[model samples]
Target: MNNEITDSGVATGLAKILADVAGRLAAAPLSARDPLHVPAVATADARVRGMVLRGVDTTRWTLRFHTDSRAPKARIIETQSAVGVLFYDREARVQIRCQGTGAVVRDGAEVDAAWEAATAFARRCYLGLAPGAVTGRPSSGLPDWVEGVRPTEEQLLPARRNFAILSVTVDEIDWFTLAHTGHRRAVFRRDDGWRGEWIAP
Candidate 1:
C-alpha cells in the first residue's frame, strides 16, 4: 500500500471499469489518505461509519481495516457478516460500491501485525474507553496523561488487547462515473468470475 496509483483517465468500456475499480481499490490503502482512504462501511443493521483503509489484496479481492475490538460494530460484524463499502473519488468523479462479507479478528497473526505496525500515537486510541460508551460529556475517551503525547511500549500493552483487524471479502463491485456528456456504469460479480457488464447509468 505504498505506491500511489493515479487515475488512468476517462474510460468507457466494461473492461476498463473493472480494471479501474481494481486499480483504485488496490491503491486506496497505500496512497489516497483522505476521503478515498476513509470509505463508509455499512453493516447489516443499517449502521455506517468511516473506516481507514489498511490494505487491499486485489488478487483475493479482500480489504483490510483496523478497528477496536470493543466497538459495537465489531460485535455486529461478528454476528451479521454482510457488509457494504462505498468509495468515492470526488476529484475523479467516480464512485465504487462494494458488497461483501466482513469478519473481525480480535486475535491472530494478522491482528498482531496490524497492531504492531500502528504508531504509538495511533495505537493510543484502543487504550481509550469503548466506542459509543455513554460519557458524562463529549470526550475523546483518551486519558489526559496520554493526550498529545506518544505512549511508550509499556503504556501500549493493554491497548493491544483492544486492537483488531477487519477483513472484508468483496463479492460484487458496482462502478459509476459522472460526466458532462453522459454517465457510465457497470457491475462485476465474483460469482461470474468478475466479468463486468455495462448497465444503464
Candidate 2:
C-alpha cells in the first residue's frame, strides 16, 4: 500500500479532497477497470458484499447499486437501512469510507432506467437462483442455458422482476490517504453541509 504513494504534491484542502472523491465516483460507473467501480458494501447486520457502482447522485448525496431483489442483502437493507460502503484505490493510496442509509427500490423510475441501461448479458444474473441459495454444489446460480449467452428480450422478461436498485443516502464520509511523508485524513458530514474537517490519520 505504501509503495503506491508518490511525492506528487498532495492537496491539503478539505474541499479539494472532497472534489477528488466526487470525480472518481463520477467516473467509476463508466469503467469496469476503475478501482472504485466495485466497492465493498456492508449492511447493518455485518454482511458485506462487493457491489457494482451503478450511479452517483451528487445532488441527492446518494450512491446507486444494482442488486437482485431476492438477494439476502436486499431484504436486510430494506429493513435495517444502515449500511457502509468502502472504496479503495491502491494506485492512489486513498481509502474512502461512507456510511449511509439504504433503500431497495424494486419498482420505480430509477430501477426501470437502470434495468433498461444494462446489457442483456449483464442483466442475466437476475435470471438465476436468488443469491446465496443452497445449491449443494459449486454454481454461478445462473441457469445452464444462459451460460456464456445473452438472452433475448422475451427471455429476459422475468429478470426485471428480480432486478432492484440499492440506493444509499450517504450521511458521512471519511477519506484517508497513505503517504511516505505522512498520512492525511478528513471527515465530512452532510449535517455540516459537507464542510469537511481534517483529522489526524
How well does each candidate superpose onto the true structure, as a TM-score? 0.89, 0.89
Error of 1 at 40 (Å): 0.8
Clashes of each: 1, 0
lDDT of 2 by residue, 1-201 (tens): 011112234434666777788888888888999999999999988988999998997767799998889989988987899999999999999999999999999997878898999999888988999988999999989999999998999999999999999899988889999999999998877763665677799
How far off is residue 102 in model 2, in Å? Answer: 0.6
Full-model lDDT, candidate 1: 0.84
Candidate 2, 170: how far from true, in Å?
0.8
- For candidate 1, lDDT tens digit of each residue in 1-201? 111212234233555667767788878888655558999999999999999899989878899999999988989999999999999999999999999999998888888888888889899998899999888988999988998888999999999999988899998888889999999887777763665666799
